[model samples]
Target chain A: MAAAAERRPVWMRAMIYGFVATWFILAAFPFIWTVWGSFKVELDFFSIADWTYALTGERTKAEYGSAFTDAGYRGAWIQEEFYRNFFNTAIVCFFVVCTSLTIGTLGGYALSRSSYNYTFWLLITALIFRAMPPVTLVAGYLLPFFQWNLWGHLATTIIVLVAINQPFTLWMLHSFFKKIPQELDESAKVDGCTQFQAFRHVIIPVMWPGVITTGLFSFLLAYNDFVVTSMLLEEKNRTMVPQIAAFLGTTYTEGNVMFAVAAVVSATVPLFILVMFFQRQIVSGLTAGAVKG
Target chain B: MKHRTFFWFFLPTAIAMLLFIAAPIVSVLIQSVFAPHEAVLIEVENCTPLVGCTTETMIDQEATRDLREAQPLGRFVGLDIYLDRAHLAIEEVGQIWSTSETWGSFWSRIFNLPFYRAMSFTLTYTFVVTPALIVLGLMIALAVNSLHRHLKGLMIFFSLLPMIVTPIIGSLILFWMVDSRGVLGSALVSLAGDPNFSLKASTGLTWVMLIIYGIWSSAPFAFVVFYAGLQTLPRDTLEAAQIDGATRWQQVRYVIIPHLTPLVTFVALIQLMDNFRVLEPIIGFNASAHATSLSWIILNDLGGETRQLSSASANSVLTLIGVAILLSPVLVRTWQDFKRKT
Candidate 1:
C-alpha cells in the first residue's frame, strides 16, 4: 500500500510539472510567435500553402530573397511616422509619472499620517473613481477640452491622464507610507524639521520601494491607454497604441498588417524589459493592493 | 501631521479628483437626462414666376445656427433615452416575452437588442472569468509553491507576461494566431476536415475564444496573489494534520484552502471589476459581429464621425449603475469591516 501510494505521487508530481510547463508556454508563446512572425512577409506569415512558411520564411525568401526582413519596421517607423507617435507616448508617460507621483506622494503622505474623519471619505471618494472606467471620464473632458481649446495637445492628454491616475497612485503610495514606523518621521519633526522637511528628509529615503512600484503602475497606465488617448487626441497628435489602432482601421484594406505587427512589437519591448528588471516589485505591488489598498 | 500642514499636502490631488473624476460622473448623469438640441428648421415664403406664390420650406440657416449656439445643452428628454429601444428596451422585452413561442427563443430574441446583448456578454464574462481564473490561479499557486525555490522565480517570470502586456496588443497577438490563415486556425481547419471552417463565422466559437483570452490574461494575477498567501500558511497546522494520518487531499482541503480563502476573495473581487470592462479584445479580434460588450457599445457610439454623445452618455450612466450594483456588496462589506475595526 505504501509503495502504491508512492507510485501515485510520482505521476502526480509529473502531472504538476506538466501543467506548470504547459501554462508557462501558453502565457509566453503568443509574444514570441508574434515577434518572430513580424519579421516575415505577409504571405509567409499567413501562408495558405503551409504553416511551415511562417517558420522557414519560404515566401519571405521569394520576396526579399532572405529569411528575414525589416520592411515592416521601416514601414511602421518611418513611412508611417510611428516615431512621432512613439515620441508623443514617451512624453505622455514621463510627465504623467512625474506629475501623478509628485502630487500622489504629498497627498498619500498626508492621508497616511492624518488621524482625521475626512481622510476616510476622501479615500472612499478616490476608490469610487478608481473603480470607474476611464472612458466615462473622457466623455466629460471632451466638451470642456474642446471649449477651452485644449483637446489634442500632449499637455492636455498628460494633465487628463495624471488626474485619472492620481487616485490609484495616492491610494498605493498612502499604504506604502503607512509601513514606515511613525516614530522615524515624528522624531525628525520633533528635532525641528517641519512636516514638509520630515517628508523631504526622513520619509523620502525609506519610501523608494513603494514609490517605485506605484510609479511602475502609473507608467503602465499612461503607456497602455487606448480609449482616452485615441478619443481625445486628433489624427496628428495620436500616441503609439492609438496609431497602431489607426493602422488597423486603414491598413486592413491596404493589407499592411505587418506595419501594425511591427509597431506592436516595438511598443511591447519596453514593457518586457520593465517586467524583466522589476518582477519582484511588480508582484509585490499587485498583491499589496489585494491585501489592503 | 498637523491638520494645517496636511491640508496643503492634500490640496492638489483633492482639486484633481473633484474636477475630473467627481465632476465627470455628475456630467454623465446630467447628459443622460438631457438630449442634444434637434437641428432647427424654419420656413420661407417664395414667390417665383414658375411656381407662383409657393411657400418653400427653406432652412433659416442663420436663425437655426443661432438657436444651436444659444442653447448647446439641448432639450431635456428626461428618461426617454434610458427607456428607449437603444437602451433599456423595456417595450421590446415585454413584447418578446409575450410573443416568443419557446424559452430559448425568448432569451435569444431579448439578447438581440443591443443593450441586453452587451449586458448579457458583460455579465457572462465577469461571472465566468472570475471563478475560472480563481480556480486556475489556486492550482498554479499550489503547484509552484511545491517547486524548488530557484525554479519558482523563473516560473513566475514567465507567468507575468500575459498580464503585463497591453490588453489590445496581447489580444492582437492571440488574434493573429487564430486568424483563419494562421497556424492555429489552419490546424483547426484540418481537424474539422472542412476548409470553410472559421471561428469568425460562428458566434459560439468566438465567445469561447474570448473567454479563453480572458482566462489566459488574468490567471497570473490570481496566481501571484495566492502564491504569496501560500508562503505564509502555518506549517504547524500541516504537521498536525500529517501526524493525524490525514491524506494529502484532506490536508489541502482543510488547512491550505482555508488559509487561502481571503486571497481568493481579493482576486475574485478584482477580476470581477476588470473583466466587466472587456472592450479591447472585441476591437482587436474584430469580433463585434459575434459579440458585443457594454463598454464596446459605448465605444461604438463614441468612435465614428457621428460622435453621438447623448446615446454614449446614457450607456455610460447605465454601465456605471451596473458596476455600482455589482460592487455594492464589496463596498458594504468594507464598510462593515471598517466599523468593526474602529
Candidate 2:
C-alpha cells in the first residue's frame, strides 16, 4: 500500500515535468529552428523539414560561400539593400542607446538619492511616458520630421528613438538605484565627495548591475526597433529590419534562402549574445525594467 | 530633506531631461498645434557698428517651398493640419457608422474600411491577449512557486528564455512550426485525424496560433512578475487559511487572489500598453498571410510614394488616443492600489 501511494506521487511529478517540458518546447522551438536555419544552405532550406535539420547538416561549399563571402555579399547588397540599411539601424540604435542611457542614468540617480515626492513624480511621469504609445505622435508630431529636412536627418531619428525609449530605461534604473541603500551615499559624501563625485565613484560601482540591465535593454530596443525606424528612416537610410523586408521583395523567388540566412544571422545572434552575457541579471532586469517600464 | 539639497540633486537630471526628453516631447505638443516648418534656428550676430547683423535659421527653404511657403516665412499654420485631420476623422466616423460595405466606406477615402478594420482588429487582439496573459501568467507563477528551490530556479530560467528571444524570431518559429509539414502540424493531424491543419489561413486556427504564440512569448515575463509578487506575499495569512480548515481552492480564493490583485493589475496594465504597439509578428508573417495590424497600416501608409504623411500621422495619433482611453483607467486604478500598499 505504501509503495503504491509513493508511485502515485512519483507519477504526478513526471506528469508535471512533461507539462513544463512541453511549455519550454513551445517557447524555445523557434529560437532553435532559427539558429539552425541561419546555417542552412539555399537549396536545403527551400523545402526544409523539421526546421532543426538545418542544424545537423553541413552547408554545401557554394551555399557557405554565398552566405559569408562576396557572392552572398553582392547578392544581399543589391537584393535587400542591406549594406546601407544595416548602417542606418546601427546608427539609430547606437545614438538611441547612448543618449537614452546617459539621460536615464542621471535621472535615475536623482530619483534614487532624492526625496519621496521627487521619486513619486519621477515614477508617475515615467509610467505615463511608458504607457504613451509611439503611434500617438507619429502623425501630429513626427510628420514634420519628414516634411522638413532638419527633422529628416539621421540625428532626428536618434533623438526621437532616444525620447521614446528613455522612460523605460529611467524607470528600470530608478528602481534598481533605489534598492541600493542611502548609507553608501551618505558615507561617500562624508568622505569629502561632491554629489557628482559620490555618484561617479561609489554609487556607480554598486549600481553596475542596474546600469548593465538598462544598457542591455536600451541596446535590444534600439536594435530590434521597427515602427519608428520604418517611419523615420528614408529610402537611402532604411534600417536593418526594413532592409530584411527589402530583401524579401528583392529575393522573391530564389532569395528566401538568403533572407532566411540573413534573418537568422542578424535577428537572432545579438539577442542570443545578450541573453548569454547577462544571463543572471536579464530575468530580473526584464521583469523589473521592461514589463514595468 | 533640505530644499537646497533637493534642488542640487534634482537640478542636473531636471536640466538634462528638460533639454533632451522633456524638450522634445513638449516640442511635439507645441508642434501638434503650431505645426512648425523648421525644427530650430540659430542666429549669429557680428555687430560692426557699421551695418552688420545676420540671422541664420535651420529652415530648409527648398523642402518647405513646395508645401507651405506661401505663408509668412517663419510663421506656423497654427492647428490647420490638426483641424483638417479632425474633420477628416469625423467624416471617417460618419462613413464607417453608415456603411454597408464589408470593410466600411470612408467619407475621405483616406479613412477607408481597411484602416478602421485594422484598428478594431488590433484593439480586439490587445483586449483578448492582455487578460489571457495575466491569467496564464498567474497560473505559471503559482506552479513555479510550488516547485522546490533548485528546480524552481531552473524552471524560471527555462520559462524566461522565450522572453529573451526576439519576437521576430519567435514569430518565425511559429511560422515554420505551423507550416503544413512542420512537427506541430503533423502532431495536430495525427491527434485530430485532420491532415489539413492550416494555421495560416483559417481564422479560428490563426487566432488560436496567435494567442498561443503571444502567450508563449510573453508569459515568461509575466510569470517572473507574478512569481516576484508571490515571493513578497506574507505567509501567515496563507497559514492561517489552512488552520481555519480552508480547502485548496478556498485558500487560493480567499487569500492568494486578494494578495495577487496588485501584481495582476500591474501586469495587465503594462500588457495593455506594450501589446498595442506590437508590430513584429504581423511584419514577419507578411500580407500574404492576411495579417493586418494597425502598426502595419501605419507602416504601409508612410512607406509608399503616395506618402500620405498627414493621414498616417492621424492614424498613429488615433491609435495613441485609443491606447490612452483604454489604459488611463488601468493606470489610475494601479496607482491607487500601489498607494494603498505603501
Candidate 3:
C-alpha cells in the first residue's frame, strides 16, 4: 500500500505529460504536414516516413536546377501554373475582404443605429442568407450566367463570394458595434461632434480590433472557398483549390505527392498568418459569437 | 438635433441594405413564383401545312409561313403543380398514375416518393448530428474549463483550428485520410490489427463518416462558446453551493447547469439551424447515390436533366417551411432569453 502511494504521484504526472503531448500532436498535425509537404518534391510526398528518413539519400543539385529550367517539360509547366493560381487566390481574397468590410461595416452600423421596425428582421434575414446552402443557388446562377454571356467573368464570381460572406461579416460587425455602448455616442454628441464625426473618430477606433478580426475571417473565407470559384471559373482561370484538385486527382506516379505538397502550401499560408497576427481577437471573437447572450 | 442626427447617420446603411439584400431576396421570392410565368411554349404550323390543311389551303404552295417558337423552359403554370401532386396515391392496379396528369411532370414531385424519403433522411441527419455536436462540444468545453490557465490558451487554439480551416480543405483532408490505403485506414489496422475496416464499405459508413466529420468540424465552435461562457460564469454562486455542503454532482445539477441554460439554448439553436442546412460534407460524400439528405435532394432535383425550375422552387420552399417549423420554438425561447439579458 505504501509503495503504491509513493508511485502514484509520479505516474499521474507522467500520464498528464503524455496527455498534453498527444493533444499538441493532434492539433498541430495538419499545419506541420502542410509545411513539410509543401517543400517536398513530388516523388517523396507519399512515401510517408520513408520520405522524411531518406531526405539526403538520392538527390542531385544539377537535376533540381534542370527541373526548374526545362522549358518543354510538363512538370515545369505545372509549377508555373501553381504560381498563377496563388496570384489569383491573393487578388480575389484581397478584393473580397476589403469590399465586404466596407459594405458590411456600413450596413451593420446602419442597422445598429436605426429605429426601423424591420432592422432585427433584416439582420435575421442576413444571417439566414449567410447560412443558406451555397449549392442550392449556385446552379441557378450558372444557368443565368451562361444565358447572359457572363460566364468566366471575375465580377460574377466576386458577387457570389460576397453574397455568401456578407451576412457573417455584417453579423460580427453588428455585434461588435453594439458592444461600443450608447453612452459613448451620447457623450460625443454633447461635445458638439456630429453623429458621423463621432462615429468616425470615436466608435471606429474603439472597434478597430473587431474590424480587423472580422476582416481576417472574411479574407480567410474568400481565400479558401472552392465551390463557387470552381463552378464559376473555367480551366484557364481556375483558382488554387481546383488547381490543387487537378494535381491531386492526377494519375501520374508523382501526382499524389505533388498534390499533398501543393495542398499544404495553398491552405496553410493564410491560416499561419491568422494565427500569428490576430490570435487573441480571433479566439475571443469566435467565443462571443458562439455564446449569444 | 439628436433625432435629426440619428436619421442622417442611419440613412446610408438602411439604403444600401434595401437596395442590395432586401431587393435580391424579394426578387428570389418573385422568381420562385411569378417571374417564371413569362415563358410559354408556342407551337406553330409551317407553310403549306402538310396533313390537314394541304388540300384546302395551298393553291399558292410557294407561300412562305412563319411560326412562333415557345419559350424553351421555366414557365410558371400556377397551383396546378401543387394540387395535382398532392392527389396522387399508390399504384395498386398497375395504373402507374400515367396519362392522368392535371398539371405536368414537374407538378408530380410534390408527392414523389423520393422527395418524402429525402425529407425523412434530412430530418434524421439533422436530429442525429445536432445532439452529437452539442454533447461533444459541451464535454470539450467542460474538460477544457477544468484546465489550468497556461494550458487553456493552447487547448483553446487547438479547438479553434477546425473552424479556421476551410471546409473544402478539411473535407479533402478527410477524404484522403479515409481512403482505404490512407493514414486513417492504416492507423485502424495498426491499432486493431484489422486491415479490412474501410469507410467506403456501405451507405451506413458514409453516414457515420459524415456525422463524425461534422462533429469534428463543429465541436470546436461549440467548445469555444461554452468555454467563454464558463469563464464569465459567476464564481460566488458555485462557491456558495459548495459551502452549503453540496456534492460535486449536486452543485453541477443545481448551480452550473441552470446557469448555463442560456448558453446551452443558444448553442442548440445555432447548431440546429446550421446542421439542418449542411450541404458540403454530404455533397463530398456523393449525395446522389446511397443516402440523400434534404439539401442534396433539392440540389439534385434542381439540376436534373428535365430542367425542372418550378420543382426546384417548390423543393426550396418546402425546405424553408421545414426550417421555419423546426426552428420557431427555439428561436422564440432565445429571443425571450435575449430580452431578459438586455
- Among these predicted structures, which one has the highest TM-score? 1
* For model 1 chain A, the run of ten residues with the poorest summed lDDT: A1-10
lDDT of 2 by residue, A200-286 (tens): 898878887778878888888787766666666666877776566555555657645455445545665667666666766776775
DockQ of 1: 0.58
Ranking by lDDT: 1, 2, 3
* Model 2 CAPRI quality: acceptable
lDDT of 3 by residue, A194-269 (tens): 7778788888888787898898888877876765786677767777765655555452445444444455455566
Q: Please give the lDDT score at residue A145 for candidate 2.
A: 52
Better of 1 and 3 by TM-score: 1
For all candidates, state DockQ relative to the true structure: 0.58, 0.28, 0.27
For all predicted structures, in order, the TM-scores are: 0.97, 0.77, 0.76
* Candidate 1 lDDT (Cα, 0 to 1): 0.88
Task: Give lDDT tens digits, candidate 1, residues B126-230.
Answer: 898889999999999988877777889999998998898889998899988989899889999999999999998999899999999999999999999999888
lDDT of 3 by residue, B1-342 (tens): 244654564455455445444553443444455223332234454545454532232333222211112332345555543333321123411243454455554344432566655665677678887788777677666656655677778887766776677665666556555555444655655566765766666767777787777777877777777777777778788778868988766976898778777777777777777787766666554433556666665556554345455555455656667777876785686568657855
* Cand. 2 TM to true fold: 0.77
lDDT of 2 at B77: 62
Q: List the pairs of residues colliding in candidate 3.
A: B42-B70
The interface RMSD values of the models, given in order, are: 3.1, 4.7, 5.3
